[model samples]
Target: MKKLRNNTALLMMTLPGLLLLIAFHYLPIGGILIAFKDFSYSGGTFLKNFENSPWVGLKNFEFFINTPDAYIITRNTILYNLVFIVLGTAVAVALAIALKELRNQRSAKVYQTFILLPYFLSWIAVSYLFFGFLSADKGLINNLIMEPLGFHPIEWYSVKAYWPYILIFANLWKYAGYNCIVYLATITGIDPDYYEAASLDGATKWQQIRHITIPSISTVITLLVLLGIGRMFFADFGLFYQVPLNSGAVFEVTNVIDTYVFRALMNSGDIGMSAAASTFQAFVGFILVLLSNFIVRKIDKEKAIF
Candidate 1:
């Protein structure tokens, strides 16, 4: 009782945050029931509507699975995330190492700020920026590069073939710098004694980086990769939806699970189906996190997130 009294102020400070978490995250979990029901409005209170809805079991889930485009969306979601994780991690780590090698702190700070600026911009803003470069008639790319090179201007939005590379590059530009910051923090925390000892032993800079820097941060790299694997089934809705201007021509390549669900919800007003899709995503993500953690435990017990 005396111990509780001693920490009363600190506990009071945490009360609001705890309440917010419970209200937003834990409280809404009961609404997962709507996914299993034929939810419909009956001109009543929201809770009354849910209560009146008939239970439909797995029908909603089956509808999503049996759709013709199901395979395409699932494949795109997983593949894009895999590419993002692999390429993003490599680029972020390389950038972090390069930043560490910079002798001038001011120049390094400026470069870091410039790289991180993209991450703060909304996807809506980025879509307009991309439009300025890829517009068919007046785009900078066609007017400046294609015209000067004696080539015809190509229609960017109408072409499906180029979207895969375009989406990947845009994803990297926005997110790579944020990931680099995490790696840079890990790199900064390394003890100086290891590098000093390596230098004394006549190790080249590349050798030191390969043997010392990489090894030192291997655990952090593994943790981040595992966390990424948990969300492999999810995609950034805005990136796939807004960046391509919702062009039907590019839907074959850019349509992901999230975008597909959004389109379905908008076109059909099927709340039950939308709920099922979200539940499916959440369930798959949970399983992936567990499976990935189990694999990590088998390989290295200490590195397992659990």
Candidate 2:
């Protein structure tokens, strides 16, 4: 009671966020029941309809588990996320280190601002920016580079082979700057005495970074990676849906579980099936976080988030 009284203002400051969390996250948890039911709006409030819905057991899960897309969407989601995690971390860390090494502080800040600007742009805007360069007929790539080189104008959207790379590049372009800023903050927080000590020992720049900087920030890196693994099942809906313009031909490559569930809901209006998919995603993500944390704890107890 004494400790609580001392931190009363701090506790009060957290009230709004705590209430929001309960309202948005905890209260809706009861709606997971809809996943197991043949949900229908008969009348009255959503709670009334939810109470009156018929139980359907695993029937709703068939949309994902028993369908042909069961493998493709799952495969795409996992693979894309794996690439994003590995490649994004590498790029972010590298950029952060490079930015930290810059002799000109003003130039570094300017570059950082430009890099992070794309991250603030909506995905809808990004799609149009991509279209400006990728449109088949009069796009800059087609008109200037392809035509000038005597090659045919490539139809970017119709081609599935190019999309994986395109999406990867787009994801990096949008997110790497924001993540770089995160890592830069971590790097900046590290004590300068470690670098000074390493320098006194005749360490090269690379050696100092390897032995001091990376080791110092390994906890932050692990935490971020673990948090990312927790969302492996959830793809960025706007990136997959808007970027490709929902081209049917490229669905084979871009169709993640999120987009697949969205399309299914749009075409069939099967709310129960959509709910089931979301529930499955959440459950799998939860299990992955636990499993990943266990592995991390085994390797290095200090690095584990829990």
In candidate 1, the residue pairs with backbone N, CA or C atoms under 3 Å apart (3 or more residues apart, or in different chains) clash, namely none
| Candidate 1: tens digits of C-alpha lDDT, residues 1-306 | 998899999999999999999999899788788889999776698888887888999999999999999999999999999999999999999999999889999999999998899999999999999999999999999999998999999899999999999999999999998899989999999998999999999999999999999998989999999999989989999899999999999899999999999999999888889889988998998899999999999999878898
For model 2 the local lDDT of residue 67 reads: 85
Q: How many backbone clashes does candidate 1 have?
A: 0
Q: Give the TM-score of candidate 1.
A: 0.95
Clashing pairs in 2: none
Model 2 residue 210 CA deviation (Å) reads: 0.8
Assess the local accuracy of residue 274 in candidate 2 as a C-alpha lDDT between 0 and 100. Answer: 91
Candidate 2 residue-wise lDDT at 207? 99
- What's the distance in Å from true for residue 231, model 2? 0.6
List all candidate RMSDs to the true structure: 1.9, 1.3
Residue-wise C-alpha lDDT for candidate 2, range 1-306, written one tens digit per residue: 999999999999999999999999899898788899999766768878887888999999875688899999999999999999999999999999999999999999999999999999999999999999999997899999999999999999999999999999999999999999889999999999988988998999999889988898899899999999999999999899999999999999999999999999899888999999999999999999999999999999999999
lDDT of residue 303 for candidate 2: 99
